[model samples]
Target: MSAALALRQAIHDRLAADAPLAALAGAVRIHDVPPADVAFPFVILGEAVVADWSTATEGGTEQSLTLHAFSRAGGRREAFALAAAIQEALHDAPLALAGHRLANLRATTAEVRREGDGRTYHALVRFRAVTEPL
Candidate 1:
């Protein structure tokens, strides 16, 4: 698998399997997009951008992985809590890439805000990943 895809898969799998995340978001509703009528607390894999980093004898890539968390709690609390767990789970945590080696992975930034609708809270967390062919 390509490094970019592998990185994303790693993040998704880590979040889906985390005990903390599961405890927070019971039933572990992580997906590409939550159903319009589905539960409030859930996570989604959002935008991603990957750049080529190829050398004469090696192939590599740099990627920006974005994830979104949504909650209906009174404030941006639940969302922020989940973001913390995600960062702890992924930042510098060794991940097995399908066909690449992760050189480094780290949390770049995370932010939470209340939507204009004023009921839903959204948290966006982004990570940077560097990988090389295995």
Candidate 2:
């Protein structure tokens, strides 16, 4: 699957699994999958960690998360929520999707694909955010 598609699925799984998602949704901002590295500020067990995007496919698409995530039990809700919200915002970003922002959004399943040495994954979805629409 395309990185964008995988991204969409990853975001959905993360959001659906996260309980704090309602609060973290405000900080999400998705961007285009560039050839360069991208970092995500993820919180684990109440601590903040940066998830990096480094692995890309031969098609010039990246699925590997550049940010390193430590192993932690529970609190997945917070992490998933944060990741989903950010992805949604980036996928719908104007600079990335451009004229196809609204059209590019997939309300159905998310895009997910496994790549690399069985250690990395990538998604094609991107989104931007601004807290909740309050």
Candidate 3:
């Protein structure tokens, strides 16, 4: 499978197996990628109120989460919390990597943005995971 597809599946499987993520139900859409980054759809696994995954590099990947809710302002807290939950969910391999575990998952940035007729709290978490070469 392609790196992106593999990354997506790994994320889905990990989240599916996670108790926290299992509470929601929705297929994670592999949305956009800018240069070296892979972005997950605003809606992931279900009503998680957040989307997240890792970068599919040749060697490894990096995890990230974005929040979507009623409005960016109102969703900020939920987003931040969900992002951390995602990080915790992928804390093992092959969900993560041998040496790669979530080193950080925090909202360093946020925005109150509009989504259709409503608004939602949007936040970003910086995920850092590392693994040795196979």
Clashes counted in candidate 3 amount to 15
What is candidate 2's lDDT per residue for 1-134, written digit by digit as tens?
Answer: 44344444444345445444445533323333322443333322111122223345312232222221211223344344344554453343332221112223222223434445343343333222211100
For candidate 1, lDDT tens digit of each residue in 1-134?
77777877888898889998888878567888778888978889888899997888878888898989888988878999988988888899899999899999999999998889989999998999889887
- Compute the lDDT of residue 68 as modeled in candidate 1: 91
Candidate 3 TM-score to native: 0.42
Scored by lDDT, the top model is 1
Candidates ranked, most accurate by lDDT first: 1, 3, 2
**Cα RMSD for candidate 3?**
9.5
Kindly list the per-residue Cα lDDT of model 3 for residues 59-93, writing each as its tens digit.
54343434332213354555555555565665444
Q: C-alpha displacement of 113 in model 2, angstroms?
A: 2.5
Stretches of candidate 1 off by over 4 Å are none
Which candidate tops TM-score? 1
Q: Per-candidate TM vs. native? A: 0.92, 0.25, 0.42
Worst 10 residues of 2 by lDDT: 125-134
> Which scores greater on TM-score, model 1 or model 2?
1
Error of 3 at 81 (Å): 1.6
Preferred candidate (TM-score higher): 2 or 3: 3
